[model samples]
Target: MRYNKLDLNLLVALDALLTECNISRAGERVHLSQPAMSNALSRLRNYFGDDLLVPVGRHMERTPRAEVLREAVRDVLVRIETSVATQPEFDSRDTDRTFKLFVSDYSMEVLIPHVLAIADAMGSRAKLHLRPQSSNPARDLERGEADLLLIPGEWCSAEHPSRVLFDDELVCVVWSGSRHAQQGISIDSYATAGHVAMQPIEINEPAFEQWIQAGVGAPRDVRAAATSFAVLPFLVVGSELIATMHARLARLVEPALPIKRMAVPFPLPPIHQAMQWHKYRNLDPGLVWLRDLMIAAAQRM
Candidate 1:
């Protein structure tokens, strides 16, 4: 369908292209072939008389015109999705909506299982696409790429609506046979012990434990770093390395692993896991339903 000689369908491709800045990836995002995406890019270039994307050092970069259109295009698509595409009333059992969520491995282990159980009991046909935490989850929510973001309260964006789902505290974990376990961990020992850290992929910022330790002028002797919090315990097993992680996650893994959880020797703040969604999608019925399910799951926890 053309409006003023512009094919409205191209806006979908344009959004993908501008967001991804790569033709093949954009095509894959929209389920279009690479050749078809190339054709769409050519047509978009012709219509706007500008190269929306250009090659730069083996990577695609958006042109100035494309940069300007990025937010505008995203906003248009979000409005259409939330306001026009959604139904007035949500019936989870009948709809085939796919809810995309950004979550950490911790949340996936502690909370997501309950959600799936509840959804299954309700006979909901909706699909869930669980994505790993991204470097810019707020941007993904703003662009309507993520239906929800489950993260610590401190990381949530103020521009969106958020609610705390559950609370967890940080605990120190050490091998059952480690010297620290036998003697009990002290502040000095915790500060000087060889530590295994969980660093978020694609994120350059310090982890929560690191930030807290920095505030107290304490430094960890990090011996190894893993991307997933679930791996921290495994890394600590049969080793002298200590790991600081969420208490809930530690409890879940402690029964099977020969690891012991100890109280943090320092006063660290509790983890308030939160759920955030786009401000404009506050009224989306399907999202509302999914959020309710998640909240219920958290309540059960």
Candidate 2:
């Protein structure tokens, strides 16, 4: 199909129809009346040379072709919305918008307090939903389910727009009264000790794997593993367990827990916390404001 021949407005109508499955609801979704939505659907059917959406009992079901076209259509719609919508300066004091943000538990520990404080200063009209980071954060952003994700630099995708909010080196954290606490950890001592670690999904990041593999020869025992980085500090307290984590987390957890930061026995890659969003959000005023706020919070951390 030629790109110039495609009708963008019909794509919007089709997307709404696909999602809502009812002509009235689809029209409401696009702020069109019933007749306008019906006309749009007829035009879309003619354009696509298929019913696109067929009435299935009480709801609409997609044709086989529409199923294959859904994702591409949605992508085009999102880009168009981003381009056409007037970028409004977000006024947290005036608008009560609830933003769903994808954040790791570690990010909550390090970034939430500052974010909340900022929200308070901005009159507390914005509500935040902290969600777990998805394996495909870019998809979430494209679908408009998650406004922003607090993620590591390694997860950055070339197609998305991202900015490093802050950077830190990794530190080994151990119980203050544990054997490794009083003395500096040596390669031999570090390898032999029981360790609690956060397991990274095998995305084939060489730097991270090299660091983990380096300590495998000594006492490198993976006694416990957790996906949540925030749990590592708590798990190390009063136990023989030791954890390697971002240095910023050590400072945040030290005063609260019976933990001390030990020098890493081997070198590890620096960790960068990045705020990631789809490029489509670049022109969205609300997204821009939220992204800036997230950057400021990360800097403060």
Q: Which stretches in model 2 have alpha-carbon errors above 4 Å?
A: 1-67, 84-87, 200-210, 215-220
- Itemize residue pairs with steric clashes in candidate 1: none
User: Which digits, one per residue and each the tens of the lDDT, describe model 1 over residues 1-301?
Assistant: 9988999999999999998888899999999999999999999999999999999999999999999999998998998888888789989999978999999889999999999999999999999999998888899999988999998888899899999999998998999999988999887777778999888778754457666577447767789989988999999988888998999999999999999999888787678999999998998899899999999999887
RMSD to the hidden true structure, all candidates: 2.3, 5.3
Error of 1 at 223 (Å): 0.8
Give the Cα lDDT of each candidate. Answer: 0.90, 0.79
| Residue lDDT tens for model 2, 158-226 | 888888888888888999998898877888777778888876463233245466676555335879987
TM-score of the candidate numbered 1? 0.91
Candidate 1 Cα errors over 4 Å, as ranges: 1-7, 24-43, 57-59
- Backbone clash count for every predicted candidate, in the order shown: 0, 4
Distance from true location, Cα of 33 in model 1, Å: 6.1
Candidate 1, residue 105: how far the Cα is off, in Å: 0.1
Estimated TM-score per prediction? 0.91, 0.76
